[model samples]
Target: MSQTKIGALQIGSALSSSKVTIQKVLDYESQIKDEACELIVLPEALIGGYPKGWDFGTRIGYRKEVGREQFLHYWNQTVNLQTDDLKDIRQMAKRTQTNLIIGVIEKVRSSLYCTTAFISNQGELNGVHRKLMPTASERLIWAQGDGSTMPLIKTENLKAGSVICWENYMPLLRSHMYSKDLNLWCASTVDDREIWQASMRHIAYEGRMFLISACQYLGSPSSLGFDTEWPDDKELIRGGSVIVSPMGEVLAGPIYGEEKLLSAEINLDDVIKARYDFDASGHYSRPDIFKLNVDQEERIKN
Candidate 1:
């Protein structure tokens, strides 16, 4: 039974500056070096920074010019794929000897998407999974992702996949990942509630896989080094990062109200043990009774 240490970085904030945020991420990784973590999951929008409590001057489909202005500001902050931003992360992953699942706002020319980049330990920018659907106000800033990036990474030890934020609630998507037999599922979210905790454990039990979720520990809008309508006593996002075993047990944390770098040891053998009776993609599945076809055709256009 091989054990892998998984690190969940829950100390992200609204820096908006990729250079600063990337430095902060490197600092956190340095602090976790003693843990010898093989895999690290960062919070969603860690680079672009989660947009909390802003209306963009929109009302009932009426968008003002200021909304356009705000979007341009966001666009400027987004990291371009063919640039130094991702290149630096890839190098960082290689140096640390750790696989990284980093969430960022990806810019491809005039468009932007909420994306998660999977960097291999060898410094390869393996793949990027953009959010399939933007939730609520997020649609204002991010474009929809296609099925092209909906696949898992087969690493040396465990197969990895990701579901960003509310997208975890999608049943068909879950079946898709389950079909791939992913053992290490990375969930990067901004959800700061108890219900999401249950969702993580439930997904782990359902898929018979080890799950790790990383959430941002963002202070109130003002404290986040930005201006917002939130009160002085408010903590915008209170960090509910956690890790779950294949048998639906909590291994690490639901750390709150503070910045934290949390880690937990996971035995890949537990996944096999838990799935002895139910392998969602194999003996436990009624493939003849039900079938799901995924189209991974590239849809990006100039």
Candidate 2:
């Protein structure tokens, strides 16, 4: 088939935990089973909550007991891919027969990393893409991902990959992924700013690929009983879930202030059509003058 339906689940972490969040995913998938969406992307940190205003009680140089406790709580919330409750997610995907690209907080030994988990429609854990860089204060909680986890997921129809949140701003990373000739670019993020929409459009136009960005729609943390600096009436993350065509047209949405699934039907041929004028990785590239070396080795810090 030259055409497929894609969607973005513009939701946030549950008020309680990732378990509840997982159930929500299952429920949503069941609701959309009739939509016939071949691929659906979920927001960043959907499994593990994105603590918007917490500092973990940290100081410049000294570590506080409360901070350590906070960190421990967060670590406990992370999903251990080896021994975690992922069966339901896979089963839901199987039931819906839809490919899922979801953001998760991955627990590895003593550290955590912001990562994307790919589940095939047949209920298989295909692979994952760990965020190469964590933005700002995120450095304190999440570890940097090595190139080894940057996978280009190939299916019967097309090639797809994910770049999480701020990692979208990395030009070289974008170029490298563009070189893979991706047909779908999934962005799992919590960045709901208006400018993020621009970046999403730019990436779609530049890569000549369909872009699906799923941003979180989190209300005030205060409602969740956390002490937050944000006003009680304010939303922590206003969703900006959107879908863009290969030619940079807004196909689905840039929806905000609500929780909804945004979907659009796209023709795979559009990727080639958009590239007729500019193919960043093909005829438009100056391979003689510019080259990128990506080390796919998984780095271990001793």
Candidate 3:
């Protein structure tokens, strides 16, 4: 590919009901498609909302029985692989010929996973990567993902890879993607402005890959269950979605306190230029001294 124009849905957290949130995603999809974006990425847990922790209990007045019931209802309502909402997204992708990477709460049997689905331009579901490890309060709601589903998805323009939230902190995980010769790294996170932007920069520089780091800002008190009496000094997630080039340059907005669709025209040739200097998994590395074994066979086995 010559140049790829990518878009990111920097959406605000929605109410736990599908009827309430799915329309917002559709609206965002329409807006991004109109911009002639080739790839569109949504934030982590965009379908079921984020930080579904004890705060959810607090939002519903902290009644254990009622909280459990609400949790069950939310889980039941949102746990889906092929819902009408996704059908609309598929149609949009088909019409626009844009690939989609959307984050959703995936229900597998009795477990719920923090998942991101990759949909091709032809509206085919390529694959899904569940968050390897849930962070802090999130562990209460989501189960950890196994190594089975963590393959770097091959697209026409790039070998793309993803890791949700705190998984970005895992050096081994980063190395795993690097070992696969990933050209594009999708870091779907739920962090604030400074940290989010910093992490994107760090990952871009470290992995020598184009980084599409998307984040969501939790502004509404009702959405995250923070009382109005809570400190105004603290911002939940100030959506700092950014597109970092292989040279660690910010191509899009590190936006704060608003919902946005950030886009960037990425040249695939940049990957070639960067690798000419130092390909971490290739020529520049000293694998003769220390070797890291990444078993690609296990991915195909599953």
User: How does model 1 fare in lDDT?
Assistant: 0.85
lDDT of each: 0.85, 0.89, 0.76
Cα distance off (Å), candidate 2, residue 241: 0.3
RMSD in order of candidates: 1.5, 1.4, 3.6
Model 1, 169-241: lDDT tens digits are 9999999989988998899999999999999999999999999999988887666666667786698889999
Poorest stretch of ten by lDDT in candidate 2: 219-228
- Write the number of the candidate with greater TM-score, choosing between 2 and 3: 2
Candidate 2 on 79-147: residue-level lDDT in tens? 987764588898888888888999899888898889899999998999988898999999989999999
Residue 170 shift from truth in candidate 3, angstroms: 0.2
Count of backbone clashes, every candidate in sequence: 0, 0, 0
lDDT of residue 9 for candidate 2: 93
lDDT of 3 at 105: 83
> What local lDDT does model 3 show for residue 259?
86
Q: For model 1, state the Cα shift of residue 300 in Å.
A: 1.7
Best by lDDT: 2
Q: How would you order the candidates by lDDT, starting with the best?
A: 2, 1, 3
- Model 1: residues with Cα > 4 Å off, grouped in runs: none
Q: What TM-score, over all chains together, does every model reach?
A: 0.95, 0.97, 0.88
